[model samples]
Target: MEEQRPCLNKAEKGCEGPVEGRPSYAGTGTLIWRCTAHDNKAYEAAQETRTRYPDSSTPPGWFDPAAAGERWDDEY
Candidate 1:
C-alpha cells in the first residue's frame, strides 16, 4: 500500500466486475491494476484475489475485456 502512495489515480466509479476494478500503473503501459481488500487488512493478509479491468464490449465482434472478448452468441 505504501508503495502505491505518492500517486494513486482515482478509480472510476461504478467499475463493476471483480472485487475491485483494474487500475493502470504509472510508466508501465503494458501492466494494469486490480484492486481488492481482504478483510480491511492493508498490511497483512493470507490471501487476496485480483481481477484485471479491460475495455468492455462495444457491440458484435468487439473484444470485451470483461468477457475476455468472447463473441455474443445467445444460442447457448
Candidate 2:
C-alpha cells in the first residue's frame, strides 16, 4: 500500500487543508499538489515575480493582476 504524504507547509497552526492539484504546462499529465495556504502563497509570489520582471512573461496559471482580485483556484 502507498502511504499518502503529508502537506509540505509546516505552519504552526497546522493547516492540513485540502490538497489541490494544478496541471503542469510541460505537455505532461503531471499534477502538483499543495495545501490551500501554500497555493495562495505561490500565486502571490508569481504575481510579485511578474511585477519585478515586467518585460518578461510568466508561465501559464500565473496570477494576473488585470483580472482584478480574481482568485487563483478559478484558473487551476
Candidate 3:
C-alpha cells in the first residue's frame, strides 16, 4: 500500500490529514492551508496516536523547507 501523509495543522492541537496547500483566506488575502476537517472524535484519536507513537518518522505532509510558503493550486 502507498504511504499516507499526515496532517500539518500543528497549532495548539494536531490533525490527521495532508496539508492540501497554502491558499489565501477568502476576502482577507491571508495565506492559510486548506486542511482536511475532522470531527471531534477523529481529532482525539489522532492526538492519541501521535502521543503514543512519538518516535514515528515524519509524515509526507509535514512541512519541508522546499515547500514552505508555496501555494496549492488545487484543494478538494
Candidate 4:
C-alpha cells in the first residue's frame, strides 16, 4: 500500500493550534495529508514562496517581476 507524506505542517496528526511551518495567515486552506514513509513538505514551501514572491506573466519566464509585455502592466 502507498502511504502518505510525513510533513510537519498543520496537517500533521495531533497537530492542533497554529503550526510553525503551516500556512495560517491566508490561502485556499487546503488540507495536507500526513504520512510516515515520505514527506511532502515541498508543497507547503512552494505555496509560501509563491505567496511571498508573486510572479508576473509579463515575459519569458513569467517569474520575472519587472517584465514588460504588450502593455506595461501585462501581468498574469
Candidate 5:
C-alpha cells in the first residue's frame, strides 16, 4: 500500500486530510507537506504577508518573500 502522509497544517487548521500536493519549503528551508486546501491557503497567506510586511521576515513554514517569483512546481 502507498504511504499516506498527514497534512502539515493539521494542528492549526484541524485538517484530517492526507497531503495532496508537492512538498514546499519554508523560509528556514524546512520541507512542508500539505493538503490541496491548505496548500492554496498557505500560498495566499504568504502573498498577503509579503505585501503587508515587505521588509520583514516571513512567517514560519512559509516561503521566503525574496522568492516570490519561484513556483512550487519548480522546487520539487
Candidate 6:
C-alpha cells in the first residue's frame, strides 16, 4: 500500500485530512500537499491576497513567478 502523505495544511489550520491527489508547487518552489478542504481554502485566500495586493513584493504560495513575468533562479 502507498504511504499516505499528511496534509501540509495541518501546520496552518489543524486539518487532519491526508493528501488526496497530486501536490502543488508554491511560488518559492515549495511542495504543498493539502487535502481538498484546505486546498480550496488556500487557493481562495491566495486569490484574495493577489487581488488586494497586486503589486506586493511577496507573492503567496500559489503564485507562479514565471506566469507573472518573474524569474526563479535556484542560485539566488
Point out where model 6 deviates above 4 Å.
Answer: 1-3, 11-26, 58-76
Listed per model in order, the count of residue pairs whose N, CA or C atoms clash below 3 Å is: 1, 0, 0, 2, 0, 0
Question: Which lDDT tens digits does candidate 6 get at residues 1-76?
Answer: 9877777556565564557644332255555667777777766755676578766665456766433223333333
lDDT of 2 at 70: 28
lDDT of 1 by residue, 1-76 (tens): 5334211112333332234323232112222333333212311211111122233223334323342212223233
**4 versus 5: better TM-score goes to:** 5
Estimate the overall C-alpha local distance difference test score of candidate 6: 0.56
lDDT of 5 by residue, 1-76 (tens): 8767777666666564567645443354545667766777777876776676676543445654433323433433
Residues 1-76, model 4: lDDT tens digits: 8544444433334443332333321233444333322123444544555566566323233432211101214223
- Give the number of colliding residue pairs in candidate 3: 0
Per-candidate local distance difference test: 0.27, 0.49, 0.41, 0.35, 0.57, 0.56
Q: What is the TM-score of each candidate against the true structure?
A: 0.19, 0.44, 0.26, 0.24, 0.52, 0.53
Candidate 5's C-alpha runs over 4 A off are 1-3, 11-26, 58-76
Q: What ranking of all candidate models by lDDT puts the best one first?
A: 5, 6, 2, 3, 4, 1
Ranking by TM-score: 6, 5, 2, 3, 4, 1
Model 6 residue 67 CA deviation (Å) reads 24
| Residue-level error in angstroms, candidate 2, position 63 | 17
Please give the lDDT score at residue 67 for candidate 5. 39
Worst 10 residues of 1 by lDDT: 42-51
TM-score of candidate 3 relative to the true fold: 0.26
Cα lDDT tens digits for candidate 2, 1-76: 8546444454423455776665422223445455676656655665675566655444445445433222333333
Cα error, candidate 1, residue 18 (Å): 12
Indicate the residue-level lDDT of 58 in model 6.
56
